[model samples]
Target: MNRSIDIFDTTLRDGTQGEKVAFSAEDKLRIARQLDAFGINYIEGGWPGSNPRDMEFFELAADASFEHARIVAFGSTCRAGASPEEDRNLRLLVEAGTSVVCIFGKSWLLHVEKALQITAGQNLEIIRDSVGFLKQHGKEVIYDAEHFFDGYKSDPEYALSTLKAAEEAGADTVVLCDTNGGTLPHEISEIVAEVHKRVDIPVGIHAHNDCELGVANAMAAVRSGCTHVQGTVNGYGERCGNTNLCSLIPNLQLKQDYECIPDEKLEELTALSRFVSELANLNPDIRQPYVGRSAFAHKGGIHVSAVMKNEDTYEHVPPSRVGNSRRVLVSDLSGRSNISYKAEQLGIKLDKYGDNVSEIVQKLKELENKGYQFEAAEASFELLVKRMTGVWEEFFKLEGFRIIVEKNVSGSSRTEATLRIKVNDQAEHCAAEGNGPVHALDKALRKALHKFYPEISNMHLNDYKVRVLNEKDGTGADVRVLIDSAEHGKSWGTVGVSHNIIDASWQALTDSFGYYLAQKQKSIQQKEVI
Candidate 1:
């Protein structure tokens, strides 16, 4: 019989140790509910004794009910020369109101001698007493043997003695930690197997990613009879990181035939990964395995062609299995297959047998050579196709535009823009002041077009990026601008390139407005047909 693996997530605890990772009390509570809904066995909330924020999280979590996961309080073993009852850290663990308590004890003699300034015997007593204290309080205890692998390598008898102490003290699980994260996969497999032979209780693994081997080491431990695995989402932790449950879960359930989460909940992997990244205010790693945006994205001409015929030709697994979709990118290297696929995805009609496909490919290459990247600026690509095929209708024509900057003695500056445009043979002119030249220009253009197309108010620019294309030319170098626009819960990107920054911004800005108008028209037309 294949036994299930227990997933203990430390994203709220150890994950926060990573640089730039932080979560509020509400954020931690929200994440705990998400993890429970996704079928995580245990969620390590935070150390209640460490900070007010962690204590606030436990207080908030006490009122919130989890459907599946048990909230765990994490702390270290009692300090040397102190009993568990007198230890403030242990006292906080009980008062945190969590059903499970996890505490780490020193396994390395070097730490025992130098860090704690205690003998090896005293360190063992700390581990034994800490676990026994939590058990006596009617709590399930998970004893973490900090630096177990390093300790085992130096003193095998002493390391095993640490696990024996926790076991004798009634630890529910003894987790072997590669605390320094320097252990190899073979060593992990051998050491865990040796521990499993000596220990009667379930063995666990908590590997770090300092060597980028956290997932590999965890997998090796499982293969050697470890039933519990501890990790953080996206491999988030101090130094490099901890074992990435995002990568390890799918690998375990799909490749190793070991159950980590419910098979049906597996489809939520991608969204969960992205959700956590958003909460942590971190950009999602597009190239991350299993759930990243670029994990199933195809770019090459040959790759797209083959993928069209058979996704299995290029993709390792079906993207749908992980709640991610396959993306076909179009660029200078795009073939007819690339454009045709993109056209379908964007709901654009094209004749596959006609010359439009080849024409668009050539035009894409020419534009890209001029520093227009269509891969990320699909809105601009769509407009290009529509114009090339004579299917695009003009929204407005720009007659002229002017900008003025004024400065005062206090180092403050004011920018104003004036623009004129003709819509359906009617001319409109407007002026506007703004914090920046681009903002002033955008406002002036919108004011001029508002009467003709009031729906333009719904679209707003959210992100703007400028890249210098010809750095060799210095200030005279051509620059490309990419603008991200959002409307009615949807977003799109447009690109422009010119020697002048204002001109480039204008081009991208106009394309952003044009794409929104075109999409709105298409939606209205579709509704009429229906």
Candidate 2:
């Protein structure tokens, strides 16, 4: 029987050490549950006794049954000359109610001499006592040799003694940490091979990404016979980050033929990644491997054409394997095939060989030459497609609109907007005040549209981004605004462009509401069918 590799996820612990990342106790529990659902072998919650939120998380986690992963508590080893049973940190790890306890010990001689103010022998004793105490308590102990690579390079004998201490004390796993993340692949491979020769126990690799070589170094360690790999989802951690399990897991399973995560749970990878980012209130990294938005997106004409011909030409692995899909983007560099493919994706049938299609293509090129990026403005592109295909019917029309802003000397600025909209044959007038002219105008417009479509009340704008089109200093530099909105469980994005910021905002807002109504109509039609 083949032995399985362990996937130890440190997202809740090390990942929160990343800059601008903080999770509440609730957020940590939610992410922990999702990681458990993702079939990770080990889930490191955090340093339980160090923070209230982490302590709460461990208490909450103990009550729930993990489907696959074992919860682990993390902390430093017992202090020098102290019994592990009396060490506060070690006791906290045990009280966290986890099956496994991971403790870090100073492996670098410099850290022992300067940081801990202790000799190398005392550091070894700390490791031995900590691991032995934890094991005596019937808990699986993982000893993380902190700064193991740099320690080995600085004093090989001292670092080897640290591992020997843990090995002799019954540590279930001895993880070599590239703490500073400065080691290269060759150095890691050589050190891991040497450690494997010296230790009789299974070795694990915990790498950081200071040199952006964490994944490469971890993979090299596996090739050198390490059985456990530790990383955070999306490479989240302090400074640069730890290794990314998103890339590591797939590589181990598909390339190395190692069982890191269960095969049946592979499809949950992307969802798990996004879910964690959401809980952390961080935007998903678009370029992350196997689980990012741009992982399978094809933009260049040559690439899209080739991908449409044979997906393997551009993609090393199938997108579906990781719960992602291939996307063919339309842009100035796009060929007719890219546009036609995008149209098909939007459920718009266009005659690729007809005059109308050629006209739309030429118009698209002309607009792109004027600095309209269709890829980022997909909602506008969809509206254009509907118009060209004669599938869109205007339900209402805009007559005129004016916005006024007044700044008070002793108070805040006030914005009042007025709108005159024509609904069918009748005209309706509406007025509203907002914090800004755009807000006032949006409120007034939505207020008017409420007479016709009350469902617009459910729509709310989520994000807005603006980009200047040209590099010009003076007038005539067009600006673009991208708007993201959601109604119910469905979300849609729209874009607008103009020299005037308010006009661009209005265009985007109109398209957003239009898309919402379109989705509503589709849902109604589906319900009628059922």
Task: Give each model a TM-score.
Answer: 0.97, 0.96
In model 2, the number of clashes is 0
Provide C-alpha RMSD values for all models, in order.
Answer: 1.5, 1.7
lDDT of 1: 0.93
- Tens digit of per-residue lDDT, candidate 2, span 47-125: 9879888999999888888888899999998877788888899899888889899999988988999999988778788
Instruction: Indicate the residue-level lDDT of 376 in model 2.
Output: 61
The regions of model 2 sitting more than 4 angstroms off are 1-3, 474-476
RMSD in Å for model 2: 1.7
Compared with the true structure, all predictions reach lDDT values of: 0.93, 0.87
Considering summed lDDT, which 10 consecutive residues are worst modelled in model 1? 345-354
